[model samples]
Target chain A: MLLEWILGFVFLIVKLTIVLIILLTVAAYLVWVERKLLGRIQARYGPNRAGEFGLLQPLADLVKLITKEDTVPQEANKGIFLLAPGVVGLMALLIFAVVPFGSGVTLWGRSIPLVITDLNVGLLFILALSSISVYGIALGGWASNSKYSLLGGIRGAAQMISYEVPMGLSLVPVVMLARSFSLVEITNAQSARPFIFVQPVSFILFLIAALAEIKRIPFDLPEAENELGAGYHTEYSGMRFGLFFLGEYITMIILGSLIAVFFLGGWHGPLLPPIIWFLLKVGIIVFTLIWFRATFPRIRYDQLMNTGWKVLIPIALLNIVVTGALVLGTS
Target chain B: MGTIKNLAEGITALLKGLATTLKILSRKPVTEQYPEYRRPLPARSRAVIVLTRDPDGEERCVACYLCSAVCPVSCISMQSAEREDGRRYPRWFRINFARCIYCGLCEEACPTLAIQLTPNFETSGRDILKLVYEKEDLLVNHGGKNNEYNFYKRAGVAMVGDKGTQINEDKPVDLKSNLP
Candidate 1:
């Protein structure tokens, strides 16, 4: 019995190590991918010098960030300043603990799941952990003792709180359809027909809310470069800045995966393996996000808040009601 | 009903923007990939300063300090000296390329056709000191822009030959024996 426990523990550690390595590498490369896409959109070449097609830019950026001086402001709260980026980066990564990448496969007479942990309330866990990342931005900004940083911090708090409502409400229909909080179960429910086909309205609502949730373009008022000088991370430098960047990109990947799981039928397609399908869905979502960025200019702050509170929240509530009625009528 | 129409218009506009960007994304990049493929510059493009020789294979610059004086950044400086034949030339001309704005003012101020701006702009160097060019560094053994322009020939300096030996010479210098 003790031998079995030890083996399970060792495998768990191995899985955790593998996920972390892959996640970090993917997060780094996603930045490169975004830049390359943005450059192409703008009719220019982006970062083609470091390695072939700028494949090694992330490596060069890593070295630069690591070697740079970690500067602390004179009047800043040093402890929180040091720890805030950790909160953001770590929380972003922690959300992936429950995400099911692919189904289980038996090896050596034992079934090993692809995911690190299959939490029953995986979706809730993701939402909650993502909420925690806001603190990192707010605290990091407030700790800097700069006016722009303070404003950015305030903007982040307000924006996140407003958008979180619509984002949560958008996912209610998915939960109703799947009848389970487990990400794996939710995915399995859509194995035949994706939630997107049935709940197209909710899907659109979810995507819009997800963009705001991630503070992407037209909703990125917190990190408004023109107004707030990079918003919550204005005073952050070196690897601390890198940590915030890592957090942002990791969140992008997580958002991409969640969108895949909820609406597009996670890891489900014909011919191709579930893992490939999952990644393909994610790649499409990421490309769409980049396209949105390239296409849309930043909306006004008032417009952002108004859209969330007035438009999206009401629509999501109505969607839930409509979905509930349809589900009852059909069943 | 009007609001729905407006929303549809807005979305359509956004879709149009996406299509435009997507089209750009598919097209070939206009980047020259500089250093690997240099774009041919215009002939009059001002960049590095060079001293050119006259058609007679003699130094053309009289070093009258006009170029140095007219230089906006004061990047040019030189010592003027008269040769044994009374032809003036720069003893030691220097141009601090670090300060050079490539304004071509020095080229414009030059009386002789010696000081010319070349289209070669690849003057980047790791060392600041390496950017400084002296007379020998700037001087080239070929006439630039207007090759036939000789300052001495035009200025009536009796350097190459005495008066009347050259076409434009007023008369031979009245040396006492020649006068007799």
Candidate 2:
């Protein structure tokens, strides 16, 4: 029994190591992807010389960030200021735990699920953790003691809260259809058919809400450079700033994964391994997000709020109603 | 009854919004894969300037300071000197491209058939000093590549003994003519 526990602990460490490496790598490459996609959209070459089409651009960025000095405000809460970025980064990493990368497979005389945890309340866990991410932004902003940062914090918190409603409501149909909160079970439910066909409106609402949740373009009012000057984490420098950047992209990845699992049919395809299909779907979704960033201009703050409450929330509710009716009619 | 219809209208508007988004998704992306595809620039693209010689192998410029005086960046610097045969020529003309705005004002200001803007705008360099163009660097053997008509001839400027000669304009109006 002791040996089994020791082996389990060892396995857990190995899984965590792999997850950390994968998340960091994905976050770095997402930055590259954004630049390249934006470049294509704007008719210019973006970072193609750092190393073989700028693959090493992220490495250069990482090095630059590390070498830079870490500065804290003199008249601010020192402990909270230091802790905020760590909180954000940890929360971002934690969301990936419930995300099922692939079906369980035997390896080295041991069966292991590709995800860290297959929690029963995975969706709620993700929502709760994501909400917690807002505190990091708020604390960082407040700790900076600057009016811009304070304003940015207020905007970010409000935006996150406002958008979270539609975002949660949009997922109701997916949960209703799957009849399980477990991400593994949800993946299994999607094995035969993707949720997109049955819940198109929910899927659309989810995409928009997820984009807003991630604080991407068209909904990036908090970080509006023209007005707020780099937003809530404006005064953050070095690895602190890097942490926020990392957290943002990781959130994007998590959202993409969620979308893939919920709508695009997680790990369900012919003539390919489950993991490959899952990754391919997630990749396509991430690329679409980048494409949106490239193509669309930022929306105004009032317009963004209007879109959440007046547009997305009602549509999400209607989708749930319609989906329920269709399911009942078919039954 | 009107409120129910209003709700239906709102749903239609939402459908329209989705349709618009679907249209965008279906259409071919306006994105240009830049490294693979080069954009075509116009013939009169404001780029760099180059000095040129005439077809007869004679320098087009006669130590004219029009280009220098008109340069907005003051990049153009030149000194005029007389040759043994009393012919005036630029001893040393240089343009510090580092300071140049590429406004093409110098080309416009040149009275002589000397400076002309070309479509070769790709002039990036690591060294600032390398951007400075000397007389030899600016001088081109061919006459203004784009300008078919020589400016000196077009302006009807007297060149040495070729005064009051060539093309429309009866004998330079014989300064003292009263036949108006």
Candidate 3:
């Protein structure tokens, strides 16, 4: 029994290490990808200087961030200010623990799941963790003792909380159809047909809400750069700022994965390995997000609120009701 | 019905915008990498200043002080001195290119066409003193814009030749003759 426990512990560590490394590396490269894509879309060659096509730019940026000074504001809350970026970074990383990239595999007479831990209430866990990450932004801004930072923090808190309603409501249909809170079960339920075909409304609602949740373009009022002068992270410098940046990018990837798992039928495709199919779906979603950044203008604050509260929430609630009825009738 | 139609229009507009950017993504970027490529500048483009010689291989500048007087930034200065052949020359011509605005006013003010602007504008240097060009640095062997122009030859000066022997001048009326 002890040997079995030890073996399971070792397997968990190995999987955790692999997934963490992949996530960090991919997050780093996504910055390069976003820059290059945004450049190409706008008729410019972005960052072709560091190495071949600026593949080494992220490395250079990492080195630069590390060597720089970690500054703290003179008249600010020191402890929360220091901890804020780490909170954001840690929460983003933690959410990935429940994300299943592939089905379990049997090796040496033992079955090992691809994900770190297949929590039963994975979706709620994600929503809760994301909600908690709001504190990171809010506290980071509040502790800075600057007017711009405080305003940005307030906007971020309000926007995130408002959007979470529609985001949660949209997922109700998915849960209704799949009949389980477990992500693995949701993926299994979609082996025949992905939920996107049945509930495209939910997919769209989730997408818009997810974009806002991740603080992407058109919904990026928190750190709008023009308005808040980098918003919550105005006082952050060096690797602390790097931490906020890393958190943003990792959340992007996480949201992409969540979208893939929820809507596009996670890891269930013919003529390709499950993991490859999973990655391809995530890649397409990520590219689309970047394309959205290039194409769309940032909506006004009033418009953002109207879209989230007035339009998205109503649509999502209606979608859930309709989906629940249809699911019951069909089942 | 109006609200529904409005929604349809909004969705299509968003899609159209996405399509436009998508099309641009496939096209080649217009960025010209500097260091790797340099475009050809026009010949008349004003840049670095130079001192040009006359077609006879003689210094065309008479050091008349007109260019120095006309320089708005006071970048140009020279000490005028007469040579052995009664030819006027600058003893120590200097142009503080650091102070020069490259307005081409000095070029316009130079009657002899000795002081001219060149198309080679890459005069940047780490040392401020290096940008202060002396007479030797500015002097070029050939005429700049017009090779045939010899200021002394056209003028009524006796330095190049006797007054009547000049190419474009009529024979000076003999002062001893009582002819009108």
Candidate 4:
């Protein structure tokens, strides 16, 4: 029994280390991919100087950020200013603990789960953690002692808070269809077919809500660079800003994973390992997100709010009712 | 019905924009990887100013102050000198390229075709004084736009040879021979 416990702990630690490294590396490289794809979309060549197609750009950026001066505004709230970015990074990283990349494979005659921890309420955990990241943007913006940051913070907070309602509602149909809150169970339930096909309305609603959740192109009023001069992190420099950036990309990846697990049937494909399949699905989703960015312009703040409160929420709620009725009638 | 049609049109329009960008994305970029691959500029394109020579290997400039006077930026300055053969030239012409706007105005004002703008516009330098081109630096061996046409050749002047020997000349109107 002790040996089993020791092995489990060691396995958990190993998976944790591997996941953290993979997550951080993928997040960094996502920035490069976005720039390259955006450049291609705009008919230009993106960063190809440093180490063959700018592969080392993230490392260079990390070094520059580390060497930069850490500034805290004199009149700003020192404590929250220092703490906010960490909150963003930590919450983004934490959500992945419940996300299963693949099914178990026998190693040394012991079966192990692929994810860090299989939380029973994995879907709820993701929603809660993602909602918590709003505090990071809010506190960072509020503590900056600048008008631009303050306005950005207020808009970001309002947008995030409004979107969370629709985002949570859209996932109701997924949860109902899966008949479980655990992401692994959700993926397993889609063995016959993915929930996207089963619930197309839910799929569409979830995608829009998730995009807003990540503050992407159409919903990115908070950090609308042209208007707010970087919004929340206007006063932040060095690794603090890096943390916010890292957190944002990590959230993108996490969102991709959640969407993959809940809607696209995670790790279910032919002629490939489950982990590879999971990665492939997430890549497709991430590519779609980047494509959306390249295609659309940022919506106005009022429009973003209207879309969330009026359009998405109403549709999501109606989707839940119909999905519930269908599931009940079929069962 | 109107709202539904409008929504459909809006979606179609967005899809069209995306399709256009995607098509462009597949096409090769028009970026001119400058510094490595310079594009061929037109011959008449105004850029760096240069002093051209006459066909007989002499300075074609009459040191006329027209270029300096017409220059909006007043970047051109020179001293007029007279040769032993009664030819006028700029003794020491200087153009502060730092101030030259490459507007081709100087080229237009030059009656002698001495001043001309070339397509070689890469005049960037770290030091400001280095861009201040003197006569020797600005002078080029070629006759620029009018390679064969020397200014004093047909200007009713006695610079190179006697005025009657000049091309397209009528021997100074010939007052002694005119009867009609």
Using lDDT as the measure, name the better of candidate 1 and candidate 4.
1
> What digit string (tens of lDDT, one per residue) describes model 3 on residues B118-149?
89988899999999999999999999999999
Candidate 1 lands at a TM-score of: 0.85
What's the lDDT for residue B64 in model 3? 92
Tens-digit per-residue lDDT, A151-254, candidate 1: 99899988988888899999999999999999999999999999999999889888888888788997899999999999989998999999999998998898
Q: Write the per-residue lDDT of candidate 1 for residues B81-152, one digit (tens) a residue.
A: 988767788999999999999999988888888899999999898999989999989999998888777776
Query: What are the per-residue Cα lDDT tens digits for candidate 2 across A1-331?
Result: 9999999889989998998898899899999888876665555567787899899999999999999999987887889889988989999999999999888789988999888989999999989998998899888888888888889888988999999999999998899888899998988898888989878888989989989888998688888899999889888999999999999899888888999889988888889998999899999988877766755668888889998999899988888898788778877
- Among the numbered candidates, top DockQ falls to 3
- Of the two candidates 2 and 4, the one with more favorable lDDT, higher being better, is 4
Interface RMSD of each: 0.9, 6.1, 0.4, 1.2
Worst 10 residues of 2 chain A by lDDT: A36-45
Summarize candidate 3's per-residue lDDT along A32-69 as a digit string, tens digits.
99999999999999889999999999999999999999
Q: Which candidate achieves the best TM-score against the true structure?
A: 1
Where model 1 places Cα greater than 4 Å from the true spot, the runs are A45-47, A68-78, A143-152, A226-229, A234-237, A327-331, B53-94, B111-114, B152-180
Ranking by DockQ: 3, 1, 4, 2
* lDDT minimum window of 10 residues, candidate 4 chain A: A44-53
On the 0 to 100 scale, the lDDT of residue B154 in model 4 is: 76
Alpha carbon lDDT of residue A38, candidate 2? 65
Estimate, for each residue in A76-113, the C-alpha lDDT of model 4 and write its tens digit.
99999999999999999999999999987888888888
DockQ comparison, 3 vs 4, better candidate? 3
Colliding residue pairs in candidate 4: none
> Which has the better TM-score: candidate 1, or candidate 3?
1
